[model samples]
Structures are given as C-alpha cells and as structure tokens.
Target chain A: MYASRTTQFIVGLFALLGIAALAILSFRLGKISILPTPGYVIYANFDNISGLKPGDEVDIAGVRIGKVLGASLSDNQARVAMEIDKGVQIDNDAIASILSMGIIGGKYVSIQLGGGDKTLSNGDIIRQTQSAFVLENAIGQFINNIGQSGGSKDSSSSQDSQQSQQKK
Target chain B: MQVVEFIERVGAYILDSILALGNFALFLIRSLMYAVLPPYKLRLTLRQIRIIGAESLMLIVLISTFTGMVLGLQGYHTLHLFGAEDSLGTLVGLALVRELGPVLAALMIAARAGSAMAAELGSMQASEQIDALTVMAINPVQYLVSPRMIAGVVSFPILTVIFNVIGIWAGYAVGCGLLGASGGAYFNNLAANMSRHDVALTLYKALVFGVVVMSVCCYKGYHAKRMATGVSRATTEAVVLSSVLVLAWDYFMGSILL
Candidate 1:
C-alpha cells in the first residue's frame, strides 16, 4: 500500500524544517567554519589581564579586526597575544585597550590602530594599553562627588568658624 | 483454591510477556548492528530517510521552539529569584538538549511514522500480500520489518539533535530579543553550558526510542493476519502501543540519563 500524497508533503515539510534548524544552529554559533584563515599574531605587554581570554573578539575603531589568542605574564609585565586577520593592517602606534560594555559585561580587547605611516609587524609590541576600568569604583566616585557637592557650603562654614575659634 | 489458580495463571502470563520482550530485545540489537553495516542499501535507506528523517523535522522544530520559549521565559523568572540570570542560557540549553529534545522528537516520530507504518503493513497483510511474498520465497521479516527498524533506529536521534539545537536557539532569540538579553552574552552562556556529552546522550536516547517504536509497530503488524478484523485492530494497537512505549521509555531513559 502506498502512503498518501499528504504523507509525502508532510515528510517534505519536516525535511525543510530540519535543514532550516541546522542552518539556524550553525549560524547562531557565530561561525559556520567554512575555511580556516591563517593570520599573523602580535603580542602586547600589559600589567594586568582583567579577564580577557581567548576567542574574545578584538576590534579596531569598533570594527572587528582580530581575536585574542592568549594572555600570560612575564617577570615585569602581562603579555596579551592576539591574532589579527591578514586582510587588516595595524599601525605601529596602535594600542590595545581592555574595555567593558557595562558593569557586568565581559572583557574584550579594543584596538585603536593609529594612522601611522608604518604598520605593526607580527611580533610588534603595542606601546599603550589600558586595563579594564572597575565600574564599582567609578560609581562610588560619582556618588561621593554628589554627596560632597550637596553638603559643601555647610562644611566650609563650619570649618571657617572652627578655624577662627582656634585662632582666637 | 480458585483465587490461587487465577493468581498462578496471571503470573504465567506476565512471565510469558517478559520472555517475549527479552527475545525481541536480543533480536533487535542484532538486527541493529546489521542495519549499520556497510555495502549499504543507499536507495532504500534514502527513501526511508526521506520518510522517517526529513518528514519529521518540521513538527519537531515547531514543538521544540515553543517548548524552549516557554522554558526560557519561565526558567528566567525562576532563576532570577536566585540572582542567577547568568545561568539561564546554560539552563535552557541543558533542558532542551537532555530532557525535552530527544523525548519530544521520539513522541512526534511515533505519532507520524508509527501509525502510518502499522496501517501500511496491516493493509498489506489484509490483502493477502504476505502469502504472496511467502509464495515468492521472500523473507517478510527482512523486507517488511528490517527497513522500518533501521529507519527508526537512525531517525530518532537525528531528530533529537535537530530539536535540541533548534529549541535552544529559539529560546535564545526570544530570551535575548524580547527579554532584552545581549545576544552575545546569551550565546556565550549556551556555548559554555553545552557539552559534547549532552549531544551524545540525546543520540543514545533517540536510538533506543527508534528501536522501541519500530519493534512495537512491527510486532503488532506481524500478527495482524489473525482475523478478518485483526488488521484494523493491529493498526490501532500499533499506534497506541508505540505511543505509550515511546513515552514510557522516554521517562525510563530520562530517569537513567538525566
């Protein structure tokens, strides 16, 4: 006995869906791994890692240009090593900075490739690098400034009177 | 004295069923290894793949997407209480991968495939097709049961993987877009929580479910030639048995694996 034409339709429908599912899954994983690109890596020395890890995206002027590959420390400095795409060029005066999107956001290496005449080579060292700024401390600084501003006049007068009485 | 005799008879019936199950299991495992052996029947396998694997994808995807969205929404609310929003990605991933994906795929395939299979086999049996095959010296077991068995064995886990991956992505879309989670963070969370082993377990479950549904439908249809109305009964019983057994084994496998 033959399965109805409806059954075939249903089967075909599901097959389409399965293929779609595979496509969607692969897409979400952020790389379908078409062909591996061989790129050169450069090293930047830092005092701290600030949680920058491998596979973290690296951007130049907010455009993705490379990826962080490794972070290790030598005797005097922490080394941040990265793989830059062969297609992209980095200036010799370029700098890598560790940035946070928000208070709880993960760390990423941000490259500000300068407009220098010469480009940095594979093992070139970036002279300037910034570590991740702690959000809690920034927030604390803001609140402290607000508190000081609100009570500044009263505190100044009290200090003036106390100083005059001590002079008397 | 009568009650004692009744108890003895019921015990014997249960024992016989158990024996039948054992023999079926042994035969099933052996048949399974053969199904995987090379010099493969690419044409038949392809047809079954279309019937079994491809045809079942949509319902599985739809079911999984919704399940994931619901789980994501509910799971987010629950997890947020513990200040564990970070874990929501992993949580939804694990639920889809280990729990919902394989089980739902098996159930859907059973409904779509198992019933149709029984009906086709039953109709053939009712029309004296088995007698014709016998006269031609063809083994009905190999021709009728083996392909479906192989199809079920192969299809279930493939569907499971589809469901799991799709369901989690759907969850990610809703959770990230509608729920205002960062797409990068949500996927990173899922990638972190997901493991190769989870996929492996899902595949294993699918294989078991495949065997269960196939054997069940086959068994019912094999004996369907007993009466004039027996084919109809067998078809109905095949659907019901396959559905129940799929669910039962789902629960059983869940307990062991999860």
Candidate 2:
C-alpha cells in the first residue's frame, strides 16, 4: 500500500524528532562517555564501611572518578572493589576515605591523590584507608573518658602523657 | 482406556508447545541474520519506523505523563513521612528512567504499533500478497520481517527516551507546581541522585522490549491461518503475547542489569 506524500512527510519528520530526543538523552541525561577506553579496577580495605554499597560514587578532590564495583569482607575487614575511569591515575600511596554527601546524605569513597611518583595499576590495592565514623562508638569513647577522668584525675593525666609520648 | 487417552492428549499438548517455541527461536535467528545482510531495504525500514515509532509517540507521552504524576503524588506522601520531601524529584526521576519509562513505552508500542504490524501482515498473508512476493523470487522473510524488526529495535529506545523526558517533566510539574514542595530542592536532588547508569539501563531495556515486540508479533502474523477470522485472531494474540513478553523480558533484564 502506498502512503500519501503528506503522510510520508509527517512520518519522516516525527521519526527524526524521535531520534533527536534519543541523542539528547544519551548526551545530557545518560551522560554516556564517548570514549572507548576500558575502566581499571582497584581495591581498598577498610575497618568499617557502614552505609556504603555497590554503585556508590568514588571521587578524587570532590570530582567523581569511578564507582564501587562490589564490596566484600576479607579477613575481618571490608574490601571494596572500585572501577575507576580510564586515564585517571591513582598514586600507590593515595588514601581512600569513606565520606558522606552531607550529614544525612548517602556515603561514598573519597580518594586523596598522593604525591608519590608510583602510580597504581589495575588490581593494585590502596593500603591507606579511613573507616566510616559511627556515632555510637564516639559516644561510648566519650563516656569512657569522662568516667576515667572523674574516677582518677591523676591516672588519666598520666595515661594521656604516656599516649602523647608514644605518638612522639 | 480413558487414562491412556488423557495421557496421550497431555503429551500432544506438550509437544505442540515445544514445536511452537522452536519455530519462534528459528524465526528470531532468521530475522537477525537477514537484518545484517546486504539489500538493506532502507526505504521500507524507514516507513516501518514511521508507522511504529512516530504513530505511537502521542500515546507514549500521555501515559508517561499520568504515570509520572502518580509517582510524584505517591512519593511525596511517602517521603514526607521521613522528612525527605526534597527527594521527590530524585525518586520520580530514577523510577522513570530506570524502570517505568522503558517498560511503559514498550507496552504502548506493542499495543498500538505491534498490533498494527500483526494485522497488516496477517491481512497480507490472508489475501495472498505474501505468496505473490514469494512467487516473484523475493525472499518474503527478509523483505517483510527484517525491516519491521530492525525498525522496532531502533525506534523503541527513541520512544522511551522521549517518554522519560516527558515523564520527568510531568513529575516536576506535579511535585513542585501542584504541591507546595520546594522547586529548587526537587530539581537539585534529582540532578544529584540520578546517574548515567540509570539512563543507559533504560535504553537497554527498551531495546530488548522492542526486539521482543517485533519478533513475537511478526511470528504470530506470519504464521496466521489463511482466513479473515484467522487474521483477526492473530492480531489479538499478537498484541496480548507481545505485551506479556515485554513485561517478562523487562523483569529478566532488570535482574541481570541490577
């Protein structure tokens, strides 16, 4: 069956509009990286990773660079596998910190780029990591310090001095 | 004697189902093979794209708008309970982009364009047009099936993207415009929480749904019995089966992609 010329014109015009919408979505909403480079995976070990899940953003200097590929437990520590974008080179000594978007926002991993000349490659692990802060633990520690100081001021002072000496 | 008859009937039914499934798989393979081969039939494909994608655009947009409004209204109440009303935009955006947009778009296409394809092909088969093409040394499957399948595959994702954009706008209109929710917070949270991965997943789901719609509807139409009633029945069955298949495929794709 042959369609009228006007009908065909309408169809062609609408089809082009639909395709244009697809292009707009892929560019603006999808943010599809046009680059064909393959992402490299790396791992970090943390003592605590509360509230963080797979697909959480991994950033460096507040700029997103990757995502959490997966999270697992190994030898009583939380191990997170990250898929970093290609061309983003992380130094071997870089630090990974569990951070939150805000006080009530979701958690993510923030990387502090290191000054070392050694760059981390695929499958390399970042050794220096900071765990998520748990409010209950801090409260408990605060209560313990208060009780200890109240019970024996002199003993608490001596303990603080000893701890400072150890740090030195 | 009765028990033996019942067993025989059951066996026949099972065998028929298996045969039908085998034919469907073969049809899908043939369509894919022919789609990539030479003699592309670009004009026919474009016409089918217009019929399938362009004709279904209004329906897709209308349904998406209502769905988005409902999501925003419901999400507003739910999030308000947790003092998270600012997240209404994020909730609606993610929900549409990641799930509802693609699924609804596919379902709409299957209902409108897919049924039309089935009916047209069915009538062609009933009236001997398919036979005439075959008699002329034309490969009916390549000319008829491949073009429609390729068009469906290419168009569904485009329709879905349009559906999602309209849906998100509708949600914003309802959430911030109708309700007293803060407009800035709604849009800001949406921008922050929505991700590229979600959009990509929507497109992937739409593509699979498109393939499912075309293959299923085309199979039903191609194999329809040579009668007017048969053509009608095939049209109904094509619409119903393609709708169900799109949903099932959506579930499977969601599981895999997630």
Candidate 3:
C-alpha cells in the first residue's frame, strides 16, 4: 500500500548501494581475483617443509614473485609447487628455501637467483632446496651436545680425584 | 501424591514445548512454500525491504563505524606491546568480516524491525484482520508473512556486506591515521591474510541469521494472544527471542563453517 515512485527510487538506490558494497568486499577487501594472473608453475623438493602451507608467499631476494600452490609427499620428501609470475626468470641453479617471516611468523618460500646460463621453464624443478629450520629440533640438538660433553668432563675429573685419593 | 503431581507437570511441560516447536516448524515451512510459489508479492516485499533494510541502514552504519574504530584502537594497543602494530588491519578486518559484522548487523535489525513486525502482526491478529483476510478467501500467511520473510532473506546479506566495508574502512582510519601505523603495512597484511573463504563465511552467516530472525519474529507475532497487552508482549518476545536465536545460530554456524 505504501508503494510509490519515490519508494521505488529509494529501493533501487539501496539495492545498487548494497551491490557496490558487496563488490568491494569480495574483490578489494577479500582479494578474490576472478581471473588468475598469467603464471608458470615450478616445483621444489624439501627434506622437511615444517608448517609451510599453500598460499604462502614465494619471494626472491626479499621480494615476492609467486605463491606456494600446494605441498605433497613423494619418495619420503616434501614436494612443493609454486606458481611464479610469467615474466620472472629462474636460472637452472636457482635455490629455493623455506623461510619464516619472523621469529614466530608464518613460513614462506624464498628463491635465490643463480648466475647460470640456462633458464628453467615451466615444470622444471629447482635442484638446490633448503628445508625449514625447525626450532625445537635445533634446541634438542644443542641440549644433547651440552649433556654429552658435560658428562664426559665430570667423569674424567672424578676419576683423577679417585686416583689422587688412592695415592694419598 | 506430590511426587505424582510433579511428574505430571513435567510431562505436560515437555509435551507443550514439543508441540510449540512443531507448530513453529510448520509455520516456517508454509511461509517458505508460499514465498517461492507463483503470484510473487514483489511490491510488498520491496516495501518490507524499505522498512527493514533501508530504514535501518543509518543505524547499522553508525554502530559498525564505532565498532570498527574500537577494534582498531584495541588491536593497535595490544599489538603494539609485541611490536606488531602493523597487523592492526589484519586483526580488525578478520574479526569484523568473520564474526562481528554479520552477528551485530542482524542483532541491530532484530531490535529495530523485528519488534515492529511483531507489534504490527499482533495488533492485526487482535483486531481479527488476519481472520478477515482468510474469510475473504485470501491466505493471510501468503499475503503478510511470506513477503516479510523474502525481504529479510534478501536484505540481511546486503546490509552485512555494507557493514563490513564501512567497518574495515573505519578501522583503517583509526589504525593508519590516528595511531600512526604504516598505511601500507596495514593494508598489505589485511590483503595477505584475507581470503574468499572469509567473505563466504560472512555472507553465509548473514543468510542464516536472516532466516532465523525472520522466522522467530514472524512466528511470535502470528500466534500472539488476542488480548489488550498482547501486542506489546509479542513485540518484546519477538525482539528477545530473535536476538538470542541469531546469536545461538551464529555460534553454531561459525563452529561448522570455520
């Protein structure tokens, strides 16, 4: 009963505003791209990926050049696929390393450009790859070394004291 | 004898609650069926949208802007201790997009439009207008309830998107402008962390909240007692019940969707 030309106009405007808002949320804020930018895929194998996940940034000399596509395990090694932007060229001897953003931040792939003549193309694997440095493992190793050396030194000193006591 | 009486009362209460639940379910089904059937009530739906969505837009905007600013201030202070104030955008954006935006917007609408719906329908029922429609061979549920339901479902997601966009910008203003955080880091972190899944979750929650809010409000009003204070009582009950249900369903959906 309240329907009128003015109401219709306002409703139309409201609908349009809502649509525009939705568009901004989806495309700009959410960063949902309808068309995937032109890119080529490359693969690297790591002994351990740690917690590197898909969508992690792939960087070259501190600059992002691609993103991790996915990670899989084959032949007891972690195989990671990265989607590199088309224009960036990767040398045959390039190295890919899994690095963290900060001390407690998320993991990402870093590429080191090599001075090789041959340029790797799509589907080529980077031969030199470094795995993620797990903090817990490093700490464990450090503690183990300390324990071993400390025990040996303490035992050796006690044995010399025992020999001196016997001589006395 | 007392024990027997207590048992009888408990059984009666259980039976009554079950019956009420069944009635509500059937009411929702009928409203949905009418909503999708032929002879669409586009005009009435538009009018209801104007009442529920457009009229409430300003309120939603005001609440959302403040909410975003508060989030930014709080996030910046907390993250500043850890030297990560730059992540303010990510924190604010994710929190609003994932949880606050849909839930708060729906609650606001429930407070504004849902109470009005209940009062209107309750008064109409008290005056026997619904019965008159039925007597005239017109379906009152189709004529009144279905259009409101359609409008609720359509308007809620739209309003939620608007709320999110405004809230994020407001947060950006506080974070970058007032707090002196780097604008690039704020937006870069936000863009990197946000994904389509988060956006989908926002819209999905809005849709479900819309269904819940409309159903509870309409159900309460449609069956409100035909008495002097019935309209006021129904309106109060509609607002309370819809708000609670919106929150409860939001938690349930969030657990599942996330």
Candidate 4:
C-alpha cells in the first residue's frame, strides 16, 4: 500500500512538470513579447456593416495590412474604428469596402488605395464606402426577381442543369 | 396522434435542458463550498496529475501533429483557389490555437484519462472499497475527487501547449518542406497574420476544458451505485457527457469571447 502511494505521487510530479514545460514552449511560439506600434485610430461610418466585427482583418487591395479595432453604433450609423500600420500610406480617394472573407466566410474591411499623391491625415473620414454583400441576401433578391419576371420563361434552371450535365 | 407525439417530444427536450442546467448549478455550488473548506490534499493532487497528465501525453501529442497537418493540407487546398496559399499558417494558427488545441486536448484526455478515472472509481465503489475507506476514516471525496480536479486544471494548459506545438510544426513541415513553400515566405505570412490575442484565447479554452473534464468524470464515478451493471453506464455517461459539453461550450465561448 505504501509503495503504491509513493509511486503514484512521483508519477504525478513528473506529469505536472511535463505539462508546465510544454506550456512554456507554446507560449514562446506565440511570441507575445512582440508588440505592435500604435497607429492613428479613425472611424468609418456606414449604414450597414453586415457581419464585420472587431478584430476582423483589414487589407490594402489584396494584401492584409491591419485589423478593425473597435465597433459601435452612433447616430443611426455603424461606427467602425481601424488601426493600420504606420508604413501604409492611405490616399485621399481610398475606398473601404466591407468584404466577406470568402464565398462563405466572415466579414472584414477591405481598403483600396488609389494612385493619388495626397495622403490621408488623422481623423480624416473616407466618404466612399460599400457594405458587405451577403450570399443569402443576394439569393433572396434573385428569387424575387425571377418571380417578378414569371412570364418571360427564361428557362435559366434548365439551361444550368444542361450545362452541369455537359461538364460531367 | 402525430401532434401529441410532437408536443411530447418538445416537452421532453425542455425538461432535459432544465435538468442539465439544474445539475450544473448544483455542481457549481458544491464545488465552491468544497474550495473554501479544503484540507488541501496535496498527495492526491499529485497522483491525479500523473494519471491525467503524464499518462495522456502520448495521445495528446499524436492528436496535435495530425490535426496541424490536416488543417494545413485542407486549408491549402481551399486557399489555393484564391492564390492565398501563403496564409496557411494564419489558418493553422487561428484554428489550432483558438479552437482545435483546447478541444482536441480535452477530447483525447476524456477518452483516455477521464474514462479511466471514472471506471476506476466506479469499480471500487462496486467492490465496497469506498465503504472500507469510510470505515477507516479516510474521506472518499478528497481521496477520489480533489486530486483529479487539481490534475485536470494543472495539466490541461500543458497538454494544450503540446497540442499547439505539434500542430504548428506539422503544418510548417508539410507547407514548407514537402509543398516547396519558401520557409521565409511561409513564416513571414504566418507572423503577419496571427496575433497574441489568439494564443491567449487558446489558453483560456484549456483552463475551462480542464474544469469540465474532471467534474464530469468525478461526478459520474462518485455517484455510481451498482459496480457491475451501473459502473459501465456511469463511465460511458461521463465520457459522452464531457465530450458533448466541451463541444457545446466551444460555441458559447466563441460567441462571448470572440
């Protein structure tokens, strides 16, 4: 009985130590020590944000360069705050779009920087913006459109089926 | 008849949810009370760490590496269509660290350590070992539950780390080594995409999972009545319930935390 207890105790200690060691390794890999330099926090007001939320990715053209920092509702408009890196120079006519991650992914802010030489300053608003287009919403609109054009007899579904079969 | 059956089904579902919530609430109160009035069973805690932590290491490691490689392969396949193959690290990091790390670790431990603990305790109860301990003045709760709880809490973080490490390396190996991705390019893209917040979220998952695993296993084990017939049911219940709770909590936690 005494021997069994001692063995159990020793094994437990060894296991605890192993766990701690593994935890330290994972923490190091995450590299939490590297801190980002603070950049200007500016708000983008839009009528709709779709699925966009805080911590979503922000991109310049197709390259991801920053993240959405804060989100709130103010004066009937959705206010979104973004923190872009200092290195990225935003032009005066840059457009920000609420982008869906993929065909069916999360929503994020996408920035399209134009060739204008002038740079945007702190607190300057980018007036040109577009909200995210949800696939479900698009499908709803398509169905509604199809119903309205009932007499046309487009036969779009039959054509689609025929095309699919040909491909197969 | 069909309408009545549907109503009955709905009623049963509601009652089951209510019962589960009530049981959880009662468990919380009991655990809280026990926390303040502890003899602090150090020896038992150590033993539990051995069984749950040490014994389960191999399984955790195996699961982690496989998970990482699979994530990279599938992520690459999908991301390639968009010419975003470089961001495989980002997907691996975000998915593994935030969700998979903790969930897989909990599932592995539940299958290995959790079920074993429940079965061991249940068998002892059936054989009257618990009664013998009671007669000898050894508190069964401390000898049985406390160590397992402490072990689960302590080792879960460690297991989580192992899970993440194996997964990340496996992903890098496949994505960079075999797939011919430039190591520098892959790592750079990985770093650019992942954030410190993701890692912190992963660790938080581990902590919660530890609590869930030990509580479910111990609850089933301690409450078991008939050793031969009832013990198997108890053990099965503990494993299934812990597994389900881990997944269910993942959804709720993501909604709240993310």
TM-score of each: 0.62, 0.73, 0.88, 0.64
Fnat values, candidates in order = 0.16, 0.27, 0.53, 0.24
* Model 3 per-residue lDDT at A33: 69
Ranking by TM-score: 3, 2, 4, 1
lDDT of 3 by residue, B145-248 (tens): 99999999988998999999999999999988998877876765676678889988999899888888998899889899998888899999999999888888
The order by descending DockQ is: 3, 2, 4, 1
Query: Which candidate's lDDT is highest?
Result: 3
Candidate 3 recovers what fraction of true contacts? 0.53
Between candidates 1 and 2, name the one with more favorable TM-score: 2
Output the number of the DockQ-best candidate: 3
- Model 2's CAPRI class is incorrect
DockQ of 2: 0.21
RMSD over all Cα atoms, model 4: 10.4
**Which of candidates 3 and 4 reaches a greater DockQ?**
3
Please write out the lDDT profile of model 1 over residues A1-168, one tens digit for every residue: 345555556556655665555454444543333466567788887766666767676787766677777888776777888988887888877767787644454577888876678888788877767656656655665576567775776555543432211111
Model 4 Cα lDDT, one tens digit per residue, A33-123: 3455456666677767877866667887667677787778988877888877677788867777787645655677888876767887667
Give the Cα-based TM-score of candidate 3 against the true structure. Answer: 0.88
Predictions in order: chain A TM-score: 0.64, 0.73, 0.78, 0.66
For model 4, which pairs clash?
none
- For residues B93-147, write the lDDT of model 2, one tens digit per residue: 8898888998889889988988888988998899999999999999888999999
- lDDT string for model 3 (A39-130, tens) is 89999988889989776778888676878889999789888999998899999888888877555666889999888789988899888887
Interface RMSD (C-alpha) of each candidate? Answer: 5.2, 3.9, 1.8, 5.4
> How would you encode candidate 2's per-residue C-alpha lDDT over A1-168 as one tens digit per residue?
445575578677876776777666555544445775388999988878898876677889867788787889998888899989889999977889897654555678999987878999999999888887655665666677777755676546644432211110
